[model samples]
Target: MTNKIDLDFLRVTHLRGPNIWTYRPVIEVVIDLGTLEEAPSDKIPGLYERLVAWLPGLVVHRCGVGEHGGFLERLREGTWAGHILEHVVLELQNLAGMKTGFGKTRGVGQHGIYKMAFRTRDEHVGRAALAAGRELLRAAIADLPFDLATHVEALRELVDEHCLGPSTAHIVEAATERRIPALRLTDGNLVQLGHGAAQRRIWTAETDRTSAIAESIASDKDLTKSMLAACGIPVPEGALVRSADEAWDEAQDIGLPVVLKPYDGNHGRGVSLNLVTEEDVRAAYELASRKGDSSSVIVERFITGDEHRILVVGKHVVAVARGESLWVVGDGVSDIIALVDSQINTDPRRGSGEDAPLNALAPQHGAEIILELQRQGLTAYSVPLAGQKVLIQPNGNVAHDVTDRIHPSVAHAAALAARVVGLDIAGVDLVCEDISRPLDEQRGAVIEVNASPGLLAHLKPAEGPPRPVGKAIIAHLFEDGEHGRIPLVGITGTLGTSLIARLVGCLVSLTGAQVGVASGQGLYLNQRQVAAGDCTGWDAGQRLLINRTLTTAVFESNARRILAEGLAYDKCQVGIVTDVEGAAGLAEFYIHDADGVASVVRTQVDVILPHGTAVLNAEIDAVAEMAALCDGQVIFYAADADHPRLLAQRAAGQRSVFVRDGAIVLGDGAHEQVLLALAALKPTTASWPTSVLAAVAAAWALDVEPTILAAGLRTFDAAATASKRA
Candidate 1:
């Protein structure tokens, strides 16, 4: 009992996309529980109590029992360390602000060793959380002290650095909901949705359709204002100024209570609002100059009202968020900094990171705040009299959702302003006394048009319901009937999978589409080899997916690849299983028996798109069994038309491909058409029944004409023979 419990990770693999476990990225860890395997939660005195005390959020995990407090019940009833670790790891990630719930634990046949997988948004954060969870769990088990808050804070910082920012993640999540696959192009916000030539990239709210010219236009405030005014859209009068003297002159010309800010600056940086004094305008000009690379600053008439941000996507206003000024009441006992902290930062929605809707108020972060305080004759150390209200920020905290209350005319004007600025997606900042009233009636005017606008306000608003701005942006990027996918084919089995994959690629290429293939021979682009030596892996498949010139892709999957790394692609339009020739040479992955081999091979069928088809070899009983697992249509293929599964498929008015009278016959129930004579096919392909039949079935599923498929088969046979001879 005095011995310290230890956990060791034997292996760690990051499944980048959909895998056998689930349809998302996951960190699969194989861990050696060592002596801890003998000890369950209930056996370790006070372990359950300690875990519940540390992570009370475990109550919401509707575990196997499927209700509130189900996991806690399991903890009390005695669960193994592997199961406990799964829940603990997930809970740690949740506490760290990267919420996730999917996890699984399975025994690896080796004594005291197990495999655990958990959903993860970022690989770095997931690994860090796993290490932290192991240490925290050990401490909890041994009744040792653990700094939970410090660990959680570090994890949150990691999330901020490694994971996608809120706006980009929101859009990615929306794309996922629409069943569009996505790949993070970099560690930052650059993300690709869909695959190959059909993919669209986005960095936050700016999509592939977002114009660089529009971004430049939005950056120039004076030009943007003029464009809106010229297009009959309400826009505030503004003038660019060079020096403090000119800023004061512009303020006077526009009348008192003018707003001063950098011409190209965004996110309310270096902005001074409702200024009536020359001294304030002069000081603000100095701050504005530092924010912009250019020396120019803009001074405009300050409209009297709450500030609002309207999100426009593809000529439509999708969301509106209103902003309010912040104030702190003097407690008389505390200084300005302490009073601001105790009053304003006390709100849970305010934090130092972008995850929080409202930013924590700190004097050091902004000179504008200090200047505002000085205008009221108070510094960070100054203590105000009791009951005195001091203004902190005059604007820029747009966190109130007002989408439902937006006046039609106001929404129209916002969309028009975005169009005038030439942005496909934009954030329009306008001032209005009442958003429910028309702009002309309320003297409302668009003050700023911003490209790559922050979407946090609408996504996680401080007040009112959250808006579906992510969905709007996704709709704008991909119009109706576009899933952002190119044609993809997958082949799996022990016999002739690589050859079948190449043949399918050849048939797809005959249609004039650029085809990319990854198989045992090599990675090929339209018959040109790009990489050599066993290219049937995740890395080779990823290259094809990311290639912008590839219109079609074919991948070869084997049992070893499935057990070790999972499939390379997310899902496939056509999945072909030539035959289950039996599991051999896979003992290294702990897949020893026939059942295990069948399970591993079924991963291919599991990924078939519902609208697509699965071409199964009816001759192999194990492969024939996979037809039931496909989410889409099934096309049975065998050498004999009398094969039971093939006969059943044809009887059920389904498609089947077989050989009859020395010819390949494609049959749909009562109708049968002879595609090509077996003798006419090249000697190499005709000799392999699994390869030729599977290729023909897959090509038929891809809608390649029979004549073209015949030509592709002949061409592939000649090339494959040449490769072997060479």
Candidate 2:
């Protein structure tokens, strides 16, 4: 019997934000390769070849060698199981269509134990991938039969079920490219795109500005057509009908070859096109009624042209996708189902998931396909003669890009249709013989105006180039030179950081802005203590960020929270570090010395925006040294006016906060302003001068007026603040 190597998973942690690893979410797994510790990949017989056979995509991983096939080179030259596991998990996720590459493996100073981390878009999918990767690797090492295809399929299903759909991710990625921060608000596509009061919300293609009334009008097809026709935009004549008799009557009145569809249907569901017979019309009416929210159906004059979906954002049309009929040629050996599977579904663009540009047609499941086959006296099980072309679907395959070919008048008509329906973002379905010609010239007509339309067709069209629909949507939500960020301050240190956060929040609130403070004292919205406990962690900080009413936010963090969970916010307008102090209880995190503590705390400085400022205590050399690491300007604060770092910074025309002649002073090299007399604030701030100075410097960086700062300082109740912390 072969002795199987034992690889045990010690722990798996999902860091949901920027952490010590990188500036994105990653899954950290601690693995103990007990007996296999002595057996590297080269030592394990047949392991390297088996892994390569299973996951050939691992060749792209650069690993430590930093080039293509570097991981394979490592496998040949000998490497640890943990390192192999990292590459395997990443490859599995890539094959499952998530496309993540960042990963690392580090030793924890223990024999046979290592921590491996890899980037993942969703935590649930990451955990599942890790488990599958572990099992696959173990099977390969043991020379056990493992079905790689089954595992990959399972991972793909998990990804489809949990991760953000492709359309939502595209929009979020575009927002990130614009330096706008995004927070997923649900397991679904709902996302918030900025911080606090400056934020905007989006759910797939729809934005917060998408009016409820507009969406209602867009859903009702008859109403939408009426509104468009009234606005002088060309629309197909349509009338709502209640039953099969009424549907046929309306179709006859509109003339033969009319289209029958649900009155409030979406995604082409329950829609049958170009029916010239009474039997086909009645059957389509039944199908439409079953698919719609109500029993109502619409019969419209079938416009003689290929179907097109025009995407409109704000005041302009951004993208256009033209549809084509789907057909399959039989070889005389297979039925319609087999032909579709072999010919059409075999296209790489077709899939059952949202990632696919076009949806795979399942004859057994699709009612429309069944009905279409019945129209041609063909069933899914019927076999056609050799060289016979059978129509599987007419229209609804709107994945071919025609944006550049669209005439300006047609674009304007689509945009006007969206405006008539009151949609900020709309998908206008128009049928025209040629997109390059004007709609009036070709007798093209707008058939439907849709809200929250699927964007994947434009993002990854089967033909032509993919459009920047996601960028267009984001641009529509946020104006030029706006990233949707509110004024934010983050404070990190051991010495009275909570007091510093509270003071900053109070001073900012005096500027007539609603403030949210997350600190050790508790979670505060303005002056109200909503939750009383240790609120200095990532969860606490997120509460402040997601609050729509909050105009300004202050967060208090420490070395332990920074090491365990990342800072709550992505970037701050002002970052304050009062002191590095020490890593007393952080031995568990492997942070032993002051240097380790300094590295952890400096994360606060690392996240300052380019136009922001960092407030550092000049007394602590470790804290003051972090000034150079900031992307923005730095403000030094100390009780002593003669502090060298403060003095040098002031000399260079930079800002500094210090005490002079019994008063707190805000100074540049060329000018100085006395903020307040220390005697007036002695009752509240004298006990913790360092914290007070840090807060004042942070407020100054936030552009708070000196008089309001003094008022906030004098009115602060040190006793009440201390009690809250307790």
Candidate 3:
């Protein structure tokens, strides 16, 4: 066998939190480049040219040069296999329809081994991209034929199976725009926005606030109609029928030209409208009865009006969409189904997926369309006479926006119907001749109130401006200024992060808040260690943030953790960077100097919320320099109160903590408060004083009282012992 190029994946880790990568989940892959280590892109014959020809879109990757076409420039300039792999994987995921924009590749101590990380919206897609990227790169390097289309097709399939459906993604995008953090609770659309006690969960268009009782009521169409009618919302006069014969009898009683539908069916499935004959009524009932939870059908008076869907969110009308009846005019040569494909289904808005505003009309959808065609005395295979108009769909597909034109009274009735059905957010289906006229004037009535309604119609209307339904949903879920986040603290450094995190947790707990800590020692909850061993990584931090009982949390982030996985949380209320002693362990990540270590550790300060605070070690010049990078307030801690960095913060009328004589001094420019004597703090280690100072500053920034801080410092040892016992 000819020598084969190998890019062996030694390990793969899914970091499901903010890490050294961007502020999203990413996959960290450890790969041994093997023979490829000796072959940079420029050194290998035709490798760069072949890769460019395969994935020319990779030129958009800005890389370190920070502009378009930068990755290609780097490739042409002789970048190694690790960096190339990062770009290839990202491009593959992008081409597969799951767009991801952040990536990084760095040395991992071993000569040929490197760590590559890229943003991953879906774990399965990320893994597939990595595998495909490896094969594609190997093929390109060896001048072997690679099926790029097939590889991309497989990754696209994974994306469709694994990523969020469009409805949930829109809401999540709105939440993200509001700066509210989100975490996927499952492999599907179930997502939790915010963290801990402040979280609100959403599954597609439905929310945690969507009542189960209301959903049940909405699902029972007959009950919903009764409820709406009782509330004076003008529901259609309908009766639930148990059999096809009963359906015809009910239709006769409702009078000629009646509607037949499943009692519990949604999305217009198994519904047949405007049947004047007994035969048509019985056929419609047979079609409707087999679809819902119960085989029960509802027969109602058919109102002569277009159907309109009114979206109600929290007692107000948020959107309105008017349905247009679907019809296909037959040509001389085409059958009915073929005519539908060429005419009705040809609309750009019609599609088979949720992203499509209107669903594609196909005879295979069963019952409704087939029966409608039969009513017209034609089968799907029948090619009607030229110029013949065959009705394909009588209602549903409310794809035309009419929100601005809806009469105030009609809007009020729609909201009332939703309220009567007990839905916090609902879609109220009403049939009316003129949406701008009063419901009473048009003889219009609310026909159905649906729970967990599809938002696609309003989000992607065919003829009018798309509505901001996602914003309305978010507003209903959370109030103004509420992003669903609990107070959080992040402590990062080589020397004192673990101790500082522990002390900060202790101080926060004294406020009667349930506090969680992820430290070098273990993960602690309420001063009790729940998990043993090192718990300062991204996984450990995620545990604390995901816990519902945690009202406040503190996490320790070290250089190794930062380089390997990234910071666990997205942003923090208080970010503390203790002394950056040296670049000791960072040799693995290619950091040989203090500046390189500072850049890695500064990621902690980068995530401080604009309204939050960053606590820096003034004793270390590099740590103090990170203060300027913080988006929030800066508080410096030092052994000496007169240290230049501490004095600078004091001069700027900012907060600082330092030792003044034998006592810990809390200073705010020309003002100083003596909190506790250094002798009072029972030190656990040589670096204990600095840790104590950093923790106090961070707690103070979080608005903890000085007495609580003093009490926590004094009792720190017993708490440690208690944590160990637990």
Among these predicted structures, which one has the highest lDDT? 2
Best by TM-score: 1
My TM-score estimates for the predictions, one after another, are 0.96, 0.95, 0.90
Candidate ranking under lDDT, highest first, comes to 2, 1, 3
- lDDT tens digits by residue: candidate 2, 1-726: 156657898878887766667778889888998988998999988998899888888888898899999999999999999999999999999999898999999887789989888999888889988998889988989899988899889889888988889999999999999999999888898999999988999999899999999999989998888888988998888799999999888888889899989999998999998898999999999999999999999999999989999999999999999999999997899999899999999999998878889999988679999999989989999998999999999986899999999999899899988988999999999999999999888889999999999899999999999999889988998999999899889888889988898889889999999999998988988867888889988888888889999999999888888767788988899999987776778876667788888988888898899999999999999999999999999999999999888879988999999999988999887599998888888475678887888999999898999999999999887667433323
Badly placed stretches (over 4 Å) of model 2 are 1-6, 33-47, 111-113, 140-143, 721-726
Determine which window of 10 residues in candidate 3 has minimal summed lDDT: 717-726
Which residue pairs does candidate 2 place in steric collision? none
lDDT of 2 at 673: 92
| Comparison by TM-score, 2 against 3, better one | 2
Q: Candidate 1: where is the Cα deviation over 4 Å?
A: 718-726
- The predicted structure with the larger lDDT, 2 or 3, is 2
Winner of 1 and 2 under TM-score: 1
* Location of the lowest summed lDDT over 10 successive residues in candidate 1: 717-726
Candidate 3 lDDT, tens digit per residue, 1-726? 135887898878887656655668899888898877888899888998899999999889999999999999999999998899999999999998788889999886778999888998888999999999999988888899999999998987888789988888889989998999988878889998999888889988788888999999999988988877777888778899899889888888889899988999998888888999988998998888887778899999999899999999998999999998888888778998899899978989888766788888887455788999999888889898899888888876688999999999999898888888788889989999999999898789888899888898888898899899888889999999999999999988877677787788888999999999999889889888888889987678878878988899998878777767778888899988876656866665567888888877888888999999999888888988887899999999988877888787888898999998888989988799999988887766323788788889999999999988888777777234544642
Cα-based lDDT at residue 143, candidate 2 = 92
Each model's lDDT comes to 0.87, 0.90, 0.86
Count of backbone collisions in candidate 2: 0
lDDT of 1 by residue, 169-235 (tens): 9999999889899888899999999999999999998888889999999998888888899999887
Better of 1 and 3 by lDDT: 1
Task: By TM-score, rank the candidates, best first.
Answer: 1, 2, 3
